[model samples]
Target chain A: AQSVTQPDIHITVSEGASLELRCNYSYGATPYLFWYVQSPGQGLQLLLKYFSGDTLVQGIKGFEAEFKRSQSSFNLRKPSVHWSDAAEYFCADYDSWGKLQFGAGTQVVVTP
Target chain B: SAVISQKPSRDICQRGTSLTIQCQVDSQVTMMFWYRQQPGQSLTLIATANQGSEATYESGFVIDKFPISRPNLTFSTLTVSNMSPEDSSIYLCSVERQGRDGYTFGSGTRLTVV
Candidate 1:
């Protein structure tokens, strides 16, 4: 069985500040990882995904994540965040038949 | 990528009542999934809605409680039978696109069982 862990429950960052959300996973084989953002009263939107490819994967809204196999981590990063970026971010590990095992999520609050 | 449109975006039902959430996809997909998310939490896979077959549910979830229907490749419905306060959560529908690209999710149906 595979699982994901997000260390941060909530994080507050000022506008234009760099942000990083930590995510670690426990999987036996090469795992497929993904980041998704969810706003209040809304469904989730995929930010990015990592399969077998470059270590650094770029996503929409200027977000990026690096897959570090040794660290078993795929941390999400953004150079500058806007208030609109404030939401709950989740990291998911793909299961057989492409099911997802999601983390508890990290709530991001952008302060002006 | 596939686009999902889920209906009954939100509803409040009495205990023991049932609510069926519908999901329609723009394109045919091989896998359709249902998930549950409690307030301020992550998503837990409820089941895989396979076309013309019985849905495969995850651990801690049973078919009797969360009955799913996939009449075709692009449409599915999840019914929360015998609802309870514990069943109050956001139910989301998703479809796998291109196997490895990513899963596209619907806006979610928020169910509050009082």
Candidate 2:
């Protein structure tokens, strides 16, 4: 079975600082990768996705992720962090059956 | 993108009771997925509801525990049966976007079993 792993359980970043969230998957081939954000008391929102073509994918809310097949990783990065960005981030992979497998998630805390 | 309306945004229930969550999609879809999110945890798929057929349950989930109904293409329901405090979690419904490889999810139903 395919699985997603998010090594970081929590990350604290100062406002306006750079942020990065790591995600790795265990699959023989490159699966459909995705990044989602969940605000406190909210549902999951699609940040971006990568199926094929460009390695760099841009998503809503000024978020971007890089798909590196060699490392089996799709890490999300933001140039600058905002207080609103403080939330839970989940990395997932879609299977052939179109079901999604999500990582444990990383809680991001933005500080002043 | 598709819009989903999920009812009973939240509810507090006593143990051994049951609560049903409904999800209605704006457009017709082939599959509607049900998921559970424990507090401070990631989402776990419960089952896949297909129109006019029995829902496919994931491992560790049974039809008796999460009986689903997909009477049509645009609507489906998931009932959390014999609820316990362990069943206290957010239940969400999702549908893959038509003509795309994306998915749209409902706002989720927050359930608290005491």
Candidate 3:
């Protein structure tokens, strides 16, 4: 049984500020982690994924995440936040059967 | 990656009525999945549809409530039988492609049961 935990329920950041969303997972083996973003009334879009990589994986929309095995974390980060970046983000892990287990999700609010 | 087209986009149905959601993929895929997102919540896997076989449902989901059909590699349908207000949620279709770590999702079908 694999599970994901997102510590933050909501986060508000100013435009041009650096942002990081925390994600931790519980998996027995090497985990496949992913970050996804969804705007209101829209389907989810993949931000990035980590399978077996160079620790740091870059994704679309200038987002990046680092897979830390020691801490069991894959946190999403952005150098500068934009107003358009306001959306709900989800962290997920896949089981051996390829079923996705998602975190509760974190809603990001970007302000000018 | 595969692109999915799902419909009807949104529907308001009465209690006890059934709704069938369709998912069509642009490219053939090995696995087609169904998910449900309750209000302000994360997505929960409903079932996995495999071509030429029966759908495998997750825990807390039963085939009697959610009947799924995968006629081929690129198309599937999920029907919510004997729906209730608690069944009001966004139903999504997804496909996994080879060599991709992530799954591509359809723009979910929002079902509002009254």
Best by DockQ: 1
- Ordered from best to worst lDDT, the candidate numbers read 3, 2, 1
In TM-score terms, candidate 3 sits at 0.97
Output the worst ten-in-a-row residue range by lDDT, candidate 2 chain A. A25-34
List, for all models, the DockQ compared with the true complex: 0.87, 0.70, 0.85
Query: Model 3 Cα displacement at B67 (Å)?
Result: 0.7
Displacement of the residue A4 alpha carbon in candidate 1, Å: 1.5
Candidate 3 C-alpha lDDT tens digits along A1-112: 7789999999999999999999999965978899999998999999999989599999999999999999999999999999999999999988767687789999999989
In candidate 2, which residue ranges exceed 4 Å CA deviation?
Answer: none
Clashes of 2: 0
Q: Residue B31's C-alpha lDDT in candidate 2?
A: 94
Backbone clash count, each prediction separately: 0, 0, 0
- Which lDDT value does model 3 have at A30? 73
What's model 2's overall lDDT?
Answer: 0.92
| TM-scores for the candidates | 0.96, 0.97, 0.97
What is candidate 2's lDDT per residue for B69-106, written digit by digit as tens? Answer: 99999999999999999999999999986544667789
Which of candidates 2 and 3 reaches a greater DockQ?
3
TM-score of chain B of 1: 0.97
